[model samples]
Target: MTARTPARTPRRTLRLPSWLPVDGYVLALLGTVGLAALLPASGAAAHVAEGAATGAVAFLFFLYGARLSTREALDGLRHWRLHLTVLGSTFLLFPLLGLAARGLVPTVLTPQLYSGFLFLCLVPSTIQSSIAFTSIARGNVPAAICAGSFSSLAGIVLTPLLAALLLGNSAGGLSADALLRIVLQLLVPFLAGQFLRRWVGGFLARHKKVLGYVDRGSILLVVYTAFSQGMVAGIRHLVTPARLGLLLAVEAVLLAAMLTLTWYGSRRLGFDRADRIAIQFAGSKKSLAAGLPMASVLFGPQASLAVLPLMLFHQMQLMVCAVLAKRRAHDGADTAETGGAPSVGRITPMTAPR
Candidate 1:
């Protein structure tokens, strides 16, 4: 009986490969979109959702203002060159590349899709993901933090201006009414948070985890309202599977170009590995959190189509950067171990940051 006892088999849990990280928030956004597609808000319901979305967006910005530490931002200014490089990559190089892609219109991308793509380029770099990736790769965390913060702050002003200039009538022409809405909905709340940060900063710190949910929930509400409007308007018919495939291909190229440029370009500029990692992650990615609300405000009813490229690109970047960050971390580890040149192509275990 003892000899007949069978050995227990270990259970194998199915998991996605490290190179392909699926973000749960992206899943939530897609689910929200599905809900909008199925049960779109219309008439009175639409009006209420729109109002709630607007108020949510304002409160989101207020939280942004409250959470950002002023002293840290001021100290980050000390690393001005690195910050400038990130800004130039985000605002200048990205826009130029987007402009060049206009040559593909009518051939590779529809006008509406192109507008979305260009808008994606004009949006700012991410803060949390940049910091998270930089930390994962053992890079200059403070610089990543500062660069992302500056890019986000700059984006609050620059994105609307850039949209008005680049997107023209497609972005509602940024009329006085649009500008006032931007100020009232985004800028004012942010400034209010900054003003009250001294009083509420501690509270935000304590409730950081809870407020994070609030942030994502607010964005999801904005998305639902935008998509519901789009559905009601029958804008879903505009995108075919063929167009989506082509758009994804174009976005892949765009992402590859940015990643390459940020990495090697920083190296040529004489940055060390850590700073280079910070620059690559910070400079190559766009912020979904910031871009979504801006799209809702700027594009109005057309926001659903306008944000499609950004939403797709956000997920794409997360997956690619997860693999890249792992490789980077492995290289960092090798450099430390060998006391010589860093290795490449080897992946280390890394949990993707949300």
Candidate 2:
């Protein structure tokens, strides 16, 4: 018999470490910032870019209002306790810690960086990451979904108001006219979307993927506009490597505190493991997507500096939570193994961000 040719094994491509969950969108954001640093818009071009960013922000809110299911939000009200716990952690506890961080002002953090750090605390929890992490940990998926949606919806009105109350004049003039502009830019479009949802809901559902691109593109436009304005103002020189390092350290502590609080506090409140997982993921994180547009509206030209801490925190949370989610999943499997049950299945792959 003729000798059979040996079968060749396929070579595997190199991959990133599984522990690191680097998001592509975050990379896109970094690229946008770099582009702005290199080639910022000027004068008339700046005005045109600003106007487009405003329109894009409005369109983004409109999409949010359209896509969120009214009935589901209403149904979610039944889990009022869990929602309340999450809201308290996000709005109340976070701000308190931010206020306490004032001691670092002009020492560890510059005034501008501190302001951004405080602004980071005031922003709402993320919708996509909260639900995504909760599901990965085999937690209450529906509660996670509802909690994140509620936080996003609440943030439209709450974030600006909180910034007005907390950040005051430092947010680059949160005046009556600014408030009116915000209402027109963010609230009005959202309400309009809700009103027209009956007619456009099906279209939106059909074009879900397209709308997601719109979402990311709009945020990119906002980023470009804000950072371009900053470049024009020459604010980039304000942040040194030392200050950035300090800011990262402060944010790491803040993230750890919130994570511990959410996990332990939920247990103290008599929640089950599933609900605690949902609460921990939902309550402990801030929404960079929601914060960027709002900062552009509320802080105007100063938004670039104001959103810097938020951008950093977003990346940090994602990496930390990715590791946490996997650990939680593995623990569950271990418990099943000891109980004489079959090995638990792996976590479901996360859906792409909405």
Candidate 3:
């Protein structure tokens, strides 16, 4: 018998499919969680990291306030209907759905995961991703900028108040002390940056790229501290593979509903295609940047688990919206090709601050 040739092993490569979207920031967050799992800070080191995380959170809001132009905010006021629609989808509709999702508990989700899911609903809409996606789809970029800014500003106050009313004891009891901490830590820094914008705006503008790194790094630090606390507290076991699968299924449904509502609802509300694009993007997504620090404050040692759903949803939205934006751009090209009026507006770079 002829000797059989030795079988060759298949080459393995580290690769993601072209259709699968993954943000670098999301990878950083996953790395931070891994670090927290392996090398969680404890004892005095934990305290120091916590303190630094607090400062990082404060600095993050400061950058937010500084980067968002007051003049742009005022200018966008003329588009009140679009802004109102986005806001309603964010605060009113989202919470109502979260309240409705209480039915999923015990069977579909653990009580703890449900609480995290609910908290995710109460968070503000994302600024950078919404702007980026809208711009990419040839949507109303200016309106997206203002709507995202407004949502963040409102969320600093509304999110905590809503969590108190909606989430109750799950959100660290939501006492006056909690609200006061939220205001002092988050609101005050944001307001300070807004107040100092005239003097520092030019500097921020000049170093936008550097400050972008700062923004992401601060968020990672916050994640590390919170997850470290959770690891130390042994709360990470609240999430199991089965429960995580259920949570993801639930979140997928929620995202699909919101996307449909934002798109169809905006069209029915008589918004043009450009404005609809902005509304769909701005209204459908939650802000992980805003949510993480707030979760750290609101959930305390339980924050790592609390923020997990938000983190997952954040990545899901980015991937889904990226695909949608590309499809939208292609549709606009098709319309132009057919000699029909181009439904979408001018093409711009996909870059936008998150």
Candidate 4:
């Protein structure tokens, strides 16, 4: 009895505060940006990095094609209206808002920054975070998954066409060369992956965790290469602290507007609580992962600045949506307790998408 177990010390692990829920991947992105600023590739190394980034972009799309299940996507098409609403919000409403913001240029935002801002609006909605948030909020998670996949597939073609039409020469124009690059770098690889998926899919599933890292690593390499080119081109001076603050403020307004529209607007359109949640999360956010590679291809050396607005927006959406998801879950629980219509779907643990 005297030799009883010694008082146990509770192990303490480091964690970010709930109020500041930053994703670890985002931190790695910031670090890669810093690395580019400090020691940018040049001369032969620049060419090498550029080549590697091009290859990485192709590989990334290949992975995207392999991971997406054709049958699931077709199955999701049965929820046609919800998917259409999300697409409208993503491609139509978001771009309209972005164009409306053009009035702020040369005052709140430089021409270059404005181009980037518009491009941010044109990119597809995220898949992983959209599903995660929808699940957390007790939304129609399957709808979210299909909506996101459709948007991404549509974006591969639409984004480039829109950029050529809107951004014009800033995005290397809509010439045959540009079209060929889009097909070769993005579409062809994706098709190849889809074709080979029967054989490679099993391997990919077995090493999903490892391949996820590879996916992220490829994007990081692309960022480093793009930022390195920007550094070499001496474009850093364009982004002053004051300009950055202004950009952040403009982006805050943009995010708030989308969130509000996607929620209330969906309700008015007859979507239920669960469908509305999926629409809001899927429609309101852009994919940094998809946008980055596309920017690198479209904007060339100016890719650095082109991706800046998107990068900031990505982090902003993550933080804001995380809080919103938790609140939504709480509201759903309260509704069930009061004998009201509970959320449509069961809440599931968040899983990383292939």
lDDT of 2 by residue, 1-354 (tens): 999999999999987787787888989999999999999998999999999999999998898788888889999999999999999998999999999999998989998888899999999899899989888887888999999988888888887888888888877456779889889999999998888899999999999888788899999999999999999999779988988999999999999999999999999999988899899999999998899999999889998999999999999999899888878777767877788334435667573242
Clashes of 4: 0
Count steric clashes of candidate 3.
2
TM-score of every candidate relative to the true structure: 0.94, 0.94, 0.92, 0.95
Candidate 2 lDDT (Cα, 0 to 1):
0.89
User: lDDT: which is higher, 3 or 4?
Assistant: 4
Give the Å shift of residue 63 in candidate 3.
Answer: 1.7
Question: In candidate 1, what are the lDDT values of residues 112-203, reduced to their tens digit?
Answer: 89999999999999998888888778788899999999999999899989998999998988689888999999899999999999999999
Better of 2 and 3 by lDDT: 2
lDDT of 3 by residue, 178-280 (tens): 8887888888998999999999999999998898888889889999999998898886677789888999999999999999999999999999888999999
Better of 1 and 4 by TM-score: 4
- Candidate 4 on 1-354: residue-level lDDT in tens? 478888889999997767456877888999999999999999999999999999999999999899888888999999999999999999999999999999998989999999999999999999999999999888888999999999998898888888888899889998899888899999999999889899899999999999999999999999999999989998788899999899999999999999999999999999989899999999999998899999998999899999999999998998888889888888988898899875455666453221
Superposed model 3: Cα runs more than 4 Å off: 1-15, 343-354
**Better by TM-score, candidate 3 or 2:** 2
What clash count goes with each model? 0, 0, 2, 0
The candidate, 1 or 3, that scores higher on lDDT is: 1
Error of 1 at 146 (Å): 0.9
Model 2 spans with C-alpha error above 4 angstroms: 1-12, 172-174, 339-346, 351-354
lDDT for model 4, please.
0.91
